[model samples]
Target: MSSDALLHTPLHALHLELGARMVPFAGYSMPVQYPKGLMAEHLHVRAAAGLFDVSHMGQLRLEGPDAAAAFETLVPVDVLGLGLDKQRYGLLLLENGGILDDLMFVNRGEHLFVIVNGACKVADTAHIQARIGQRCAVVPIPEHGLLALQGPKAVDALARVVPGVDKLVFMTGAAFDWNGAALYITRSGYTGEDGFEISVPGPWAESLARALLAQPEVLPIGLGARNSLRLEAGLCLYGNDIDTTTTPVEAGLNWALQKVRRTGGARAGGFAGADKVLAQLDGGAPVQRKRVGLVALERVPVREHTALQSTDGQAIGEVTSGLLAPSVDKPIAMAYVRTEFAAPGTRLNAIVRGKPVPMEVVTMPFTPPRYHRG
Candidate 1:
C-alpha cells in the first residue's frame, strides 16, 4: 500500500517527534524503530519498561444476555464460564478445523471485551456480526486506542500513572479513571513480560502515552522491537506462525482450549470445526504434523518459510518464525514438522539458501515468560 493511503495511529505525531522510522504495517503507518534502533529498544524492554502504541489492533464489545452462549458457538473456548474481569486467549476457527485468527477476550461483568489482530479485525468483526448479531450487539470500538507497557518494571511505571493497576494479576483487568477519563487496564502483554495493556479513549491516548513516557524507566518502543520480543517469547505472529490454514492443535495451542470445551464436557463440540478439532483432540483423527521449537546448531539465522528436512534429507516441515534471538544469543525458530520428528533433541536441517543448517527440536519460549500471576 502507498504511504499516502496508510492510516495513522493517535500517537503518530509523537512517534515522529521521537525520531521514529515509520513503516507500513497492517494498513497503518506505524513506527518500526526509533533513534535508539531495534536492538537497543528490544534490550530496553527486557531490562526496564517500554511503551508501545498498539491502537491499530481491534477493540470491540459483545453485549446482551446471550453473548457468552452465542460466542461459544463460534470459538472453542469456555466463554460461558469466563469469570468477571478475567481474560482468556481463543481462536476463531474455520469449518475445516483451521484458525481464522487468534484473539484475547475478557469478561467485563456487563459485557465481553475482545481484542483482535489489526489485520484480521475487519474479517473477524464481520464474521462475529454475521453469526451472532441477532443474539448480541457486536460493537467495534475504533474510537479507543490501545497501549502496551511491558517489561519487568512495567507495573511500577504504569501504576504511577494509573493508581491501583498494580493490583491486577496476569489475565485480569478492571476499569479505572485516568485523569477523569474512563480506562480499561489489563495486566497482559505479548512480550512475555510482566506488563499491562491499557485501553483508553482515542482523545486521551496521546495524553496517556505522554504520561507513561514521562516515567524515567519507560521508553517509546516501536514495531521492530515488538516483533523480535514476541518472537523470543515463542508467541505466534498472526500471518506468519498461524493463519487461516493452521489449526489450533497443530499450532500447539491446545492448552488455551479449556477442557470444558473439549469432548465429553458439558459444552463439548458446538464451535466451528468442532467435529474435526475434537476428533484430532481425542486421537480419532491424529495430526500428521505438530509445531515445535528449533535451536540452530550453527550461527545461521534461520527464517520463516525455510524448508526443513531430516538428517538424511527427506522433507519434514518448514520454519514459521525464526531469528538470532537477542536474549538467548542463539538462532532459534518455530516450525511444524512430521509428528515423528517433533520430539526434543531430534536433529533436523533448515535448508537456507541450498545449504543445510543443523538444528535440534527443543522447547519454546527461548526465554521464560515473566508474567505477574499474583
Candidate 2:
C-alpha cells in the first residue's frame, strides 16, 4: 500500500515529536523505534517501564445476553466461564482447526470486550458478524485507542497516574476514571512483565500517554523494542508464528483449550472445527508438526524462513521468527519441526548462507516471566 493510503494512530504527532522512525505495519504508519534506538528501549522496558502506542489494535464489543455463548462457538476456550472483570486468551479457529487469529476477551458484566490484531480485525469482525451477529450485537469501538505500559515498574508508573491500578493483578481488569474520562484498564500485557493495557478514548490517548511518560520510571518505547520483548517472552505474533495453517495444538497452545470445551465435559465440542481440534486433544489423530523454541549454538543470528535440517543434512522444518534476543544476549528462534524432533535438548541445524548453524530445542520464554500473579 502507498504511504498516502496508510492509517495513522492517534499518537502519530507525538511519535514524530519524540523523533520516532515511522514504518508501515498492518496497514498503519507506526513508529518502529525512537532516537534512543532498539537496544536501549528494550533494556529500559526490562529494567523500568516503557510506554507504547498500541492504538492500531482493534477494539470491539459483543453485547446482548447470549454474547458469551455466541462468542464461544468461534473459539475453543470456555468464554462462558470467564468471570466478570477477568480476561482470557482465545483463538478464532477455522473449520479445519487452523488458527485465524489469537485474541484477548474480557467479560465486562453486560458485554464482552474483545481485542484482535490490527491486520486481522476487519476479517475477524466480518466473520463474527456473519456467524453470530443474530445472537449478539457486534459493535466496533473505533473511537477508542489502546496503549500498553510494560515492565517491572510499569505498575508503579501507572498507579501514580491512575490510582488504584496497583490493586489489579495479572489477567484482571476494571474501569477507572482518568481525567474524568472512562478508562478500561487491564492488568495484562504481551511482554510477560507486570504491566497494564489501558483503553482510552481517542481524544484522551495522547494526554494519557504524556501523563505516564512524565513519570520517572517510564520511557516511550516503539515497535522495535515491542517485538523483541514479546519474542523474548515467547508470545507468538499472529501472522509470524501463527496463521490459518497452524492449529493451536501444533502451536503449543493446548492449555488455552479448556476442559469444558473438550470431549466429555458438560458443554463439549460446539465450537468451530470441534471434531478435528478435539481429536487432536484426545490424541486420536496426532499432529505432524509442532512449534518449539530454538537457541543457536553459534553466535550467528538465524532469521525467519531459514530451513531447519537434521545433523545428516535431511530437511526437517523451518523457522518462523528469530532474532539475537537482546534480553538473553543469545540467538533465539521459534520454529515448526516434526513432532518427533520437538523435544527440548533435541539437536538441529539451521541452513544459513549455505552453512549449517547448530541449534538446539529449548523451553520457551527464554527470559522467565515476571507477571504479578498476586
Candidate 3:
C-alpha cells in the first residue's frame, strides 16, 4: 500500500511532536522509537511508566442472547462462564488446529468486548461475521483509540487523572467518565507489567495521551520498547511468534484453553479444529515440536529464523523470536524445537550467521511479571 493510504492513529500528531521515529506497522504509521532509543525506552518502562499508542488494534462489541454460545464455536475458551468485568485470553483456530489469531475478551455484563491484533483484525472480523453474525450483533467500534499506560508507576500516574482506577485488578475492566468522554479502562496490557489499556473516543485520545504524559512518571514509549518489554515478559507477538501454521498447544498457550474445551468436559469438542486440538490435548497424538525459551551462553543475540541444532550437529528446530533482553542483560529467545529438547537446561546450538552459538533451553519471562493481582 502507498504511504498516503497508511492509517494514522489519533495520537499520530502527538508522536510527531514528541520526536518519535514513525514506521509502518500493521497497516498503520506508528512510532517505533523516540530520541531516547530502544534500550532507554525499555528500561524506563521497567522502572517507571510508559504510555503506548495501540489504537491500531481492533475493538468490537458482541451482544445478543446467544453471544457466548456463538463465540464458543470459534475459539477455544470458556466465554460463556466468563464473569462480568473479567477478561480471558482466546485463540481463534482453523479446522486443522492451526491458529488464526489470538485475542482478549472481556465479559461486560450484557455483552463481550474484544480486542484483536491489528494485522488480523480485518480477516478476524470477517471470519466471525460470516460464521456467527446471525447469532450475535458484531459491532465494530472504529471510532475509539486505545492507549496503554504500563509499568510500576502506571497506577500512580493514572490515579491522578482517573481517580480510583487503581481499584481494578488484573484481567478486569470498567468504564469511567473522564472530561465528559466515556473511557473503558482495562487492567491489562501486552508488556506483562501492571498497567491499564484505556479506550477513548478518537477525538479524546490526544488529550488523554497528553494528560498522562504530563505526569512526571509517564513518558511516551514506542513499539521498539514495547517489543523488548514483552519479549522479556515472555509474551508472544502476533505474526512473528505465532501465525496460521501454529497451534495453541504448540505455541505454549494451552493456559488460554480452558478445561471446558478439553476432553471429558461439558463443552468438549464443538469448536473449530476440535478433533485435532483435543487429540493433542489428550496426548493421543504426538506433538512433533513445541515452543520453548532459550538463553545464549555466548552473549550473542539469537534472532528469529535462526536454525537450531543439537549438540551432535543434528538440526532440531528454529528460533521464532529472540533478543538481547534488557531486563536480564542477556540474550534470550523463544523457539520451536523437538519435544525432547524443549525442557529447561537442555543444551542446544543456534546457528547465528553460519556459526554455532551455544544456548540453553531456559524457562521464559527472563524478567518476572509484575501484574497487580489485587
lDDT digits (tens) for residues 289-345 of candidate 3: 999989999999999999999999999999999989898999999999999999999
Estimated TM-score for each candidate = 0.99, 0.99, 0.99
For candidate 1, write residues 1-374 as lDDT tens digits. Answer: 99999999999999989999999998999999999989999999999999999999999999998999999998999999999999999999989989988999999988999999999999999999999999999999999999999999999998889999999999999999988889999999999899999999999999999999999999999998898899889999999889888888888999988888995856988999999888888888989999899999999999999999999999999999898888888999999999999999999999999999999999888899999998
Which rank order by TM-score, best down to worst? 2, 1, 3
Residue range 73-150, candidate 2, lDDT tens digits: 999999999999999999999999999999999999999999999999999999999999999999999899999999
- Runs in model 1 deviating more than 4 A are none
Model 3, residue 76: what's the lDDT? 89
Cα deviation of 146, candidate 1, in Å: 0.3
Error of 3 at 283 (Å): 0.7
User: What is the alpha-carbon lDDT of model 2 when measured against the actual structure?
Assistant: 0.94
